[model samples]
Target: MPWSAMRRVIDVSGDGGNNSGPPVEQARGRSVAERIVINGLAIAKDHPPFAYAGPVPLEDYYREAVIGGPGAFVVPAEDFNQFASAVRRKMIREMAGLPSRPRMALAD
Candidate 1:
């Protein structure tokens, strides 16, 4: 099947904001314009080894500057320790076609 026949989703997973690239919001705008959904898996840490270029509240940065298109949203994982489950949950929701809701998934 052609890619156009399926949902076009870009999973933007990162430990920091867009450090080296075109402005994230501009890229998101371009993707949204193309009818592509952009979801974020932000690995927010209490003490990041590297400096984050964007504002505080990484999830908020993702929501505003990274995610776009219908039902686009962000899922935050506190650290790499939680990355696997966060990804699992994100994939489940996306595959299930669940409506977007900005909420952290507590580890089970």
Candidate 2:
């Protein structure tokens, strides 16, 4: 199927980086170019420290990894406590097609 014809998103979440599938950066780039938003949910618990060293700040990792597109976004749950809420909010935002915002004026 043509990339532009894609209407749904593929949300992938995991506790570690690409150890089992295709490289993430390459996948993300293709998705972005096709106008497909890729939202991510990364778990920081229950993993080897070395392999999952990830971002010193976990949010930074999500920002760089999971959310990459014109309107891509991610929600870091930190621990399980925040998982439900984060997922809910992220889903709402994605489904709603981002919130309406004021237009910014650019200087000519």
Q: What lDDT score goes with residue 16 in model 2?
A: 55
Q: Please write out the lDDT profile of model 1 over residues 33-81, one tens digit for every residue.
A: 9999999999887674553546668888898789999988899998889
Q: Give Cα-based local distance difference scores for all models.
A: 0.85, 0.69
> What's model 1's overall lDDT?
0.85
Superpose all Cα atoms of candidate 1 onto the true structure and report the RMSD in Å to 1 decimal: 9.0
Model 2, position 78, has a per-residue lDDT of 61
Which structure among the candidates has the greatest TM-score?
A: 1
Q: What is the C-alpha RMSD of each candidate to the true structure, in Å?
A: 9.0, 7.0
Kindly provide the TM-score of model 1 when superposed on the true structure, using C-alpha atoms. Answer: 0.80
Mark the regions of model 2 whose C-alpha exceeds 4 Å error after superposition: 1-6, 46-51, 98-108
**Candidate 1 has which clashing residue pairs, if any?**
none
